[model samples]
Target: MTGNHNAAPTTQNSAADIEMEPFTPHRHEQCRRFQIVSASGLSYEIFVSIPRQAPPPEGFPVLYLLDANADFALADQVLERLSRRPEATGVAPAILVGIGYPETEGYNQPRRHFDLTAGPTRDPFYAKTALTFGGQSAFIAFLQDRLKPLIRSRFPADSRRETILGHSLGGYFVATLATAKPDLFSGYIAISPSIWWDRDGLLASLAVPSPSRPQTIRLYLAAGSQEGETATGEQNAGTQTSAHDALRQRRRMIGNVRDLAERCKAVCRDAVDLRLDIIADEDHSSIFVACLPKALRFTLPFSSAD
Candidate 1:
């Protein structure tokens, strides 16, 4: 969801009229970094921060994903903190696989536009940008076909204990994958997904029927107070704009997430656990940091014996 080298913001820089506010420090946790490479012929990096002083056992729970950029470090730290609690010992050792941008010029925007979208459109947001915006299908192929294999080769991980995390645009891809390929993961953490993407076309994609009986999937969705900086952020049918635009956008987005979650549940309620967290006093950027601990607790909870 985060772009690099101060690349152009995803939308027009009209007045910061719709710009959301910053995050409170109380919501953040410390994090660290471990590196890995992507299969896209790019020497990318992954950040894997484990719980402090946690012993390596038979196997620790794992989360593997893209968009490690910066927020992922905090996510690693948050997971580390959560894993140390008495209720979370088994879960804290969770190994995070953060896929970083390949260190190359113009690498940030291309990956952002490509890995986050499904396909092309003539909309203003993407019409003038590079043509690499909708390579999510290929990106998913890379994760399922290459990155997961590489991680399994390196770690003693149980495929059933895997979780995937992504924010904003990355969250969009995560949602797309959950609906399109539900069996690839056991849980999903999507922080403030870009529900406004492609004119909200992603929701329609979710309505597609499944070939096999849908399996129960663990899913969490969250958004921040300042998430609404554009049409994508919040909507007000009454007031044009007000002090509540950001909050409203976050609410609307969360509502959409809940609605989508319910729709999926209708198909396979026995197999799906969908949760929504619309955190207070956070915006787009700080949301991942705030929700990290909760995400870890919910996705990788420990069992009594193990």
Candidate 2:
């Protein structure tokens, strides 16, 4: 486990356990940038990266990444660094589309909670946290009716090879979308998803084999084994930190995802290509970045050189 200093960094303090805002990386020419308002009137900052090489006849697979403010640069760099030798890595060239907030902060906390959660939030997890919730429907509408159409028309993207990825709360969103609309995308990557959002959690209600989501879905879920354990540091000091830590353990992030993966496996069966990875010593934050390369492989698989 060596660290690359050049790689874009994404981190949120343990203090704001519920909040996810990663360090914004310096913009590079590889990523085209723009701003667009969803029909719901929510403004979003979009970051897109096209392959350096020519696309296949069917076009390149496309990935729609959530929480772009933090992970866009990291994702783009990962694709660029590995895709050069797709035959060996199985991480092929694909269109990278990052969906983020237009606000200046590393992450727009209020907006994200609203955009990521499904329906109204009655989760005890947010008893003390004062953030808005339940706007995923509107956000999904934007992606379907607005952003996606724009991507197809403007880029040589394969309609059937799209993937949607998210971490933490964003991971919660990805998982929710996977079940509610399994046929919406070909692949799903959810890292350290916040399944504690409800008692039965998000996947409790997802009915499978709905005439869609059969044999075409690829799902990869991951969480760090250490995600439930408490860490020692000033950033995690005080009573509030203890409360969150206790909850973290109770919530069982790794187990939650593991259960979801298994459930998806048994229930969906041949309907979905499902995989789960538990990073040995990583935590919630570290697990997201640590698992990106694998996520890409599962979602956008490339044939290995014989």
Candidate 3:
């Protein structure tokens, strides 16, 4: 049939043109979400990732990750990829639990500042800023009394294989927990820990005796080679010369971490297995991602025959 070339084209109600449901982000296949209230009455969002394989005879190992709002995705992905081929990687499959705040901000900065720091800042510079501190004790109580029990009830967790991973302020929290309650976790991975916090008081306090425990403790401490450097002198000069001050601070951080590791080894004696690393060509901002793979290998090592 002949038709006019200028005639209006017919429209069809094809599947693509039909109305469809709104798009929602696809959830991770093995991850689940839940909420729990802390001892201080703060509600926290917890993300749990379980392995696809069946649990071993003892149970699945568990890793408690801090700063979950920002780090959970990376932790989950790394665990999944490495554990996929345990024979090649020597990393076993395990459960990963990320503890994060429910606030709209990816992180609750004020709460973290209060929870992570062991005590008030003695440095005049930080003191002038009026930041809050000294909530580590309460947070640890919450973890021990409230969170850990809940996790145990919900999952087949191997208490002996439990590990904790933290970076920056979270790393500081890890250190505080390791010293204050050494029996809590079997392994601790503190990447670029803020040993320089509170005028190095935390590092200084490491000289005190850690609680004696029968279980072997594995600790992995790492920092970026470029951390705390003033290579470009880009900051503005103030009461203190920014570049010089920054360089000094960086040197202090490196030194303090090394000293803390050594002191921990001494006090822990044969009970603790400590390993410290300086990641090449990395800095404070980039260290976490760069060091996480090695940190995971160290903290979660497994044999090929397993």
Best by TM-score: 2
**How many clashing pairs per prediction, in order?**
13, 0, 0
Of the candidates shown, which would achieve the greatest lDDT relative to the real structure?
2
Candidate 3: the clashing residue pairs are: none
lDDT digits (tens) for residues 1-306 of candidate 2: 111112243341122132223333453444576666666556677778888778888888999999888888788888888888898888889999999876544666777887887655555666788665678888899888878877887778988789999998888889988877887788999998887775275667664745643356888899987776664432456444777777777888977888788788777877888889998878777887799999898888996321
lDDT of 2: 0.76
Candidate 3 lDDT (Cα, 0 to 1)? 0.72
Cα lDDT tens digits for candidate 1, 1-306: 333423442332222222222222222322333333334443344444433444345566678755766556466556656666636344546777777774533236566666678777544455576456556776677678766765566556666577898887778777776776767787888888766565356656653334363545678788875554443333344543664554455446666676677777786566667778877767777787787777767788787644
Ten contiguous residues with the weakest lDDT in model 1: 12-21
Q: What is the C-alpha lDDT of each candidate?
A: 0.62, 0.76, 0.72
- Candidate 2 TM-score, true structure as reference: 0.84
Q: What is the lDDT of residue 25 in candidate 3?
A: 20
Point out where model 1 deviates above 4 Å: 1-43, 50-58, 86-91, 104-107, 121-123, 199-201, 207-215, 225-252
